[model samples]
Target: MPYSRTDLKLEIQTHFDKGFSRDLKILDVGPGAGMYGGLLSEYSDILDYSLGFELDCLEIYPPYIEKFKLKEIYKNVFIGDICTFNISSYDYIILGDVLEHLSIDNAKKVLNTINKNNQKCMVAVPYLSEQGEHEGNIYEAHLQPDLTPEIMKQRYPSLKLLYGNDSYGYYVNYNFNKMKETLVIEYNNLFKKPIKPIYPKNEFKVNFIKGCKFEVIGENKNNYHVEFINQKTNKVIYETDITNNMWTKPSLEYFVDFKIRITDQNNVVWENKFNAENKRVYIHFASNAIGDTLAWFPYAEEFRKKHKCKLIVSTFWNDWFKDTYPNITFVEPGEEQHDLYAMYEVGWHYNEDEDIDYNRIPSNFRKMPLSKTAADQLGLEYREIKPKLSFKKNKSQISGDYVVIAPHASSHAKYWNYKGGWQTVVDYLNDKGYKVVMITKEPMYDDWHDSKLGGTLKGVINKTGNFPLDERANDIMNAKALIGIGSGLSWLSWALGTPVVMISGFSEPYSEFEDCERIYAPKGKCGGCFNKVRLDAGDWEWCPEHKDTDRHFECTTSIKPQVVIDAINRQLEKTP
Candidate 1:
């Protein structure tokens, strides 16, 4: 039997691993592309010591000789007919398919000339013959008759036959020395499937869902050992009886990839990679905060254009974005189906002990505002992100003409603490003839303690805690300008295209808004502490004890009330 190139390589490694020294001298009569020699070289690298392929070659084809030179597999190249090539002593010699192209008389002469030493040799002759007339070289056509195991033995009686079969031609020892155990392998069944011909130890990729048929010749199709490995976890996920050609690729509902291996009792026959690239892909948006949600909108716009993906997001800010970005097919968080990437792949793991590489996540998101970072990392072109929200004018949220002031934050640290900060601005705006309307949210308000944020003012429309968030949003849209601390309402003010005077020491202006009047304390290292949200950074430091003192608003306490009053005035002067 004619042995496969891989089968020959495996046999060489298995036999040599048992006893051969680290150094070897090999003769290859025809080493096209060095595929066999390359495999042998790689296997030698894996050994504790090196097995140098100090190789000698006998090939007449000029193109292939140059190809071998490029492969760097052979130590010396001798061009001529093997029949007259200078004979040399060698540790191991490979005939490959060289004998098939020579007349039977010449083939026998070369074999006999080489066997004069009883040196180890591997011989292969194709059972089904083909005149592979390569590159217009008529001399390369097969000229010898097919040689069987019985015939091969009869032709060289002095040579000790180690292994021979109809499928793979034969192996022999010239010295007729102590017989070494020979390794045999066959794969006619697998050859039926149109796998790109490969040397040993190369990977093939397959669809995880549409698996493949793996039936070696003569073995029952269902009798091979199969293994499915989860690539994400690097763990064996499945092992059992395979239905031969009927083995369907298993599904990874949560995981998107795996490494699949097929083997018989002796060795691994084949291996392949299986990833979710073939499956449907879904990108999930799970954050509920309005600002955070909209930040990802630009990413969505570019993602839809780049991939045939399903967008799975909540209805939190649906009205503001649904019409702006129509390609997105929104879904409830629980209803999300992940075929490709998912939010959980990048989220902060709750368990600290679990090792996960955040930088390895395949998404565009990072922990920063849109002004500071791109919405996605995968280089998708997206529209520039500026404060954006779509809504119409509603005058009822305010009485008569007015300027809006929204001054509340979720935490006290983000609260502007300059004494009379808002009150001073309110008095100044009132003096400028612009009626001031200070808006506040419910329950968080209720007490009508206007003095707490700044101070209560007469003639200032105190719409404190009265309007729903929707009404407040509309009111912001209608207002000539809005002034507030760094809070959701400040975000709303900018999103609605209304001019805003944002005051906070916790974050820098460049890190938040693209165009706006930013009032921040610049006196301390604590400036822009909002970006340092790490737990160890301590809750966005605020020296509230110095509220009435000069230290208030960190370094920004020096920004007088007139500064903000003038900023609001300038905004009112502009044409929208």
Candidate 2:
């Protein structure tokens, strides 16, 4: 919606003034961030301008998404390419100097799509131009240089040409004043209301084998509408407002596809598909993060053996879920039909002021591994928490028996070896005649600290790369034992049936692991500040108490190398 007044932009603004009313929805196709000129700035000078009418924008860059989101300027921002995404019908779909950036075929496709959708089209491109890309995306390099008014007219004969220059290809002008008198009524018929937002709490849930229900706990529930969709047939099976604080589910026998669409008063729409089956009862795991998702596999395994129904996991890690459990169904959160779904919740942020919400999380839930806690809460026959990957074993980098020493973490504070502690561990393992493999994917990973593992100790392997996550999971499973921080591998190794020596820098031992030796920083001294509220482990940022301490990150530095070695020895001693 925002644009700067380059001469071409001004001309486009004049066309809007000449034809469009404030009511007709206008779309700016691939409008460059217009960093220099947001919406109103195009009509006036840069010095004084204010955002006026709500505008729609389609941008691809993430930074731009955040910028527009924070600006709250646009009614909606579609974070995708105009070519691939659906080009809906609009009163005015302006291509503000945007055509040259796309391949000729893509540009033609967009123009054809808009035309087919019966939407008004505007064009602007550089004639016979070289690569003139704006900032950020490299693919933004201009591709259609030979774009000219003659070519556009030939491609789209019905288009009425306004002005064309060697610099800017074409502006297909519309005599909106004449259209307002003649075609305004016909055009307004195509106008759509503004989109709104709704909620089931999360993005989507899949396979609500039956139907889902909601209980809106707040007054804002009156402002939104919840919808259930049959995915395969594209049917709205149910939709209603939560005025009574009761979101009851509709009786659905069997649905091939399941989706939830939430629309708010303003017409904003958010839809997500959750995997659901009509006949089978399913397990609903409450999580969206990878670590939390992986923690549920043990329960899934036990649940699978006991029940004939499939496991329905609600998480964002769809591919990971599918790859991990070929038979299990994965869905986004909140799409589960509560009438069919039996929610398995571990924790929620400390937000609800009522007792009802707090009652959902089982007491002492945070005190033990969720696998055991959940199993006990459900009164299921408790089995040893054995998390094993269903995927076949992957090849290892080193052939011989090796103990993986994971030194890298999401943050430096979680690391046990900031000051030569890991060097001692690797050297300790090397003397023990066991190869030490270090695997990591932290982009900000420093190597100087790992100078000793510089492929010098023929026994040490640095298996770090941008490889698939499965390979990492497989490595953890096959390793003799894993000596790592409180990371995904730490969780995976334990679940994959391999013993783990867990070293914690920012968390307590009870909450994360059991049946294993754990070394943690004392809470009084920068330790165990994790839960829903204080979620992040050190990501180069420090916990408040440890940030500027005279001890220099004593939380992690406090753990001695021998402590890790002893833990590893204890685990290895029990192996086989």
Candidate 3:
């Protein structure tokens, strides 16, 4: 159970002598022979640097504490598992042949934990070396035998190779603390990516700025003045003086050319601009709403192309966009990303307070188109960008000239409330030599209105049931045209390149995509309340402004069934 190699220990000592301050806290994990601990303790007792080092030893095997005299070498000898041990307080950590013993996931988690806490770490592993349990210590066996310099770099991108050979490799993560000095803005739609901020370390001294956690370590924190500037226009975005040792800012940020200037006590100024070129940037879709995700997805690609960043995106519906966009990395919700240059979130922010919502979006979301909100948040040019969907191609269940109608929405307010609206359109389509297929997750029943909103109409094929999204997309793809409300299916129909005849009066025409054939009551007829008023989700029959009046719900009720028929006819004519 003793380490035979002295070269690695000497190399580590050389690194320490070169730059590391003697006044530091160190943790030696799984020190087999206590060689590194002994060396650190010897330095602690010798001459002027004698009263500086605080060395701790974490040995998993309790017997090793006595066998190696770890008690004499370390100031505190803690007997515990290294994988679960809290390494946050230490300034430097040495994982000497410790990672090879842990499972691959546990090994990665250990490194991730250390890096996340901004701790400087040194890891050494025997390259492709295989060993079984040594002595009575079962923890001495190498669980990972194929670890190499290339494999380590691939698995842990933050690690920098200090020294390596065919026998062993010594990796250092000094850059782990680099994230702390840089601002990390995280947006979580489905997945989160931390944007890395570049800092000139020698000039302005600030440590730790990842996410919402911020810390500054220097003699006098009051002497530090930080200013955030918009690099594009030279306007000051934010400025603050560091009064305490720790300062944290809100994680949400506008996608802009961020320039940071820091003035230290000596009046030494440091400035750096936000650059994500070749760096990983994350954009998350916080809302799981299908329409919102589809509308915002195009801008995510645009952000990637514009910034020239390695883009990672998270959406509730990743399968819909993953295949079509092979260039972008799509992750599931809540997956962690390391070494991110910047992060952004794209979705509808419902908070009416400008103070709260302005951090997420620059302007009122209700005033902008659904897709334009993403464009505005990311500082991209406003334009309609349709996301291409990839799905399994199969014969649509309904074979022949058919028209798909999705009449259900989350709220009854988004439904087409015209009298006999859906049935009349179904009859009209049936008379127009087209089979009408109703594709909804389920029949919509509005309890407040005490009526079934969308169900199988007479003389129409009822395809309404809980079906897979890709399957529904395929059905929409094969259809000649789709008639739906201001719902996800209407957006899906448009994304599939199908002519969409959208019938809804609760929202403005600009609220949805412009290309869709939108049918709404004129402005004076009491429409567009969904965009103007804060939607009361609990109220099933929410008729804002005109509620309980003669004109209650007249926005859609006033829109006759003939208007929808004409829109559908016009769309079909234009498409064919």
Candidate 4:
């Protein structure tokens, strides 16, 4: 399955045109023929080096190798298994139409290997369906694995599927155009709105009107005023007072080009163009809560006529929501929450009721399952949110001097206190001439600096809370191996397919989804705390009978530093 030299040149040129200045080393693993190597020879400007490995000697013929001058281009074309080949040095690796020949297990193993090594790669396979049969009478060695975009996504969420062209022999590019476009649109929409205007009711009334018809209708002491103005000339024409909420008939000649501005006790509530000749659409914002009322005002103003009902929201979030979404109607939480056509609650708790009728609640109030009780009431489906971090390969340096020790968790309750084990491990690694880089939060810097164990560690770099989320993920992805407590970073390392040693203090390793090898706290009375909810002091903090007292550091402290170093050595030995 060889692509034409012209097509390969065009692909390389496309990457070059997009400012891909970094050296483009192409790795054609299991290259059936030296045709791809020959294609690279046509584009010397873009191709810095081209290497191919084939299992059979027949694939790399003497004439073919001699014609391309394989040795001169540093082609390194050889006969070997792609599984055994080290691919961390290559910028781009291609596995075209080779997956169908391997067994399902082997295919998975190969994919895992490719993911572990290559930062970016292109994989292509024939579009095979259960009903369809292979048209080509090729070798019997080819065995198809169940392959599709959906299956691939399930196996490798980070590997984006790209459009393939038939001209390239069933080749799919790895570039993610749609996600990039979405990010660009989101960035542009951030600057679309301007700040809103704030004016007092009395100030607004004095600036726009003079006198108006005033009347006290209800128990409230404030008076209702109807001020008249000429719309065409922008001049106050007439004013009057009425005790009841009724309009007074004006002379036909005086009513032409007239408008009315209604003011509340301290602010202008309503304004309308009162043209008798033509009917006009009206929109209003109302809410039970102060926060909801403020948040809905601006959204109502922006899309008032476009919607059938007032754009109502919770009044509690009005101040913050107003800054971003300004045209919504705000309503209070508990005061007979009804008015808007639809309602969206930010934090809704679920109550236990399998057959509760949601329709009984007003269509306006947005229902969301915020709590476990609410989720039960609504029969809402929920999933544990996985850590997803996007990373770009830094080609600046293929290798580095330092070993980063990333330790820190968002919550103290979940974090397993490792005591001084990290320092001990760092001291051991540092003694072997490896610089230690510790990734943690700023608050823990003093803790690490003041420790007696820290004195033994040399060439230590503290990247505590300095790197961005994605960059931090990238750092872990490129690390030799991560040795840390069971935090989100451990989950991230598992997702990235990196070697990790999780220091489980109060949790069990078997409870988590399997991805990589893990070493957990030695099993005892206090182990396997798999309960969904947090436990009380007497309840099963780890086991049913184990009571959490003043001393709860046994799980973390019991695991020796030598044990961690041994685990690291074992993982490093296994990882290619």
Q: How much is 105 displaced in model 4, in angstroms?
A: 78
Give lDDT tens digits, candidate 1, residues 212-291: 22233321233556677756678876676554434444332222345667776747878766432323434444456555
Alpha carbon lDDT at 558, candidate 3: 85
Per-residue lDDT of 75 in model 4: 44
Best by TM-score: 3
TM-score of 3: 0.63
Tell me how far the alpha carbon of residue 433 in candidate 4 is from the true structure, in angstroms, after superposition.
4.3
lDDT of 1 at 89: 67
* Candidate number achieving the greatest lDDT relative to the actual structure: 3
CA deviation > 4 Å runs, candidate 4: 1-389, 396-402, 411-418, 448-459, 530-550
Model 3 lDDT, residue 172, Cα:
87
Which is better, 2 or 3, measured by lDDT?
3
Kindly report the root-mean-square deviation of model 3 from the true structure over all alpha carbons.
Answer: 17.3
Candidate 3 Cα deviation (angstroms), residue 219:
5.1
Model 4: per-residue lDDT, tens digit, 93-202? 66655666566677677667766764566665654422222333132144654566656566555455543433232333345564556544543544333212111112
Off by over 4 Å in 1: 1-280, 338-357, 360-368, 371-374, 377-383, 387-390, 395-399, 442-451, 523-526, 533-556
Give the Å error, residue 68, model 1: 38
lDDT of each: 0.57, 0.59, 0.75, 0.45
lDDT of 4 at 488: 51
Q: Write the per-residue lDDT of candidate 2 for residues 1-576, one digit (tens) a residue.
A: 122224444334334444556666767666554432254323333213332445677776656555333245456667787888766746667786677677777877887787777777777666666664455466567676676677767765656766555556445534444644434443344333321221112222233333445444422335557777766568887887645345546554322245677677858456666532333444555555455666655666465555545556555555654765676677776674444443444333233552323334334454455556556433355555655455567787678888876656666556673466766777888888788777666421355544422323244576776657778877776788988777777777776777888888666677675766788875556666553234454346556565665665677667777777887888889876
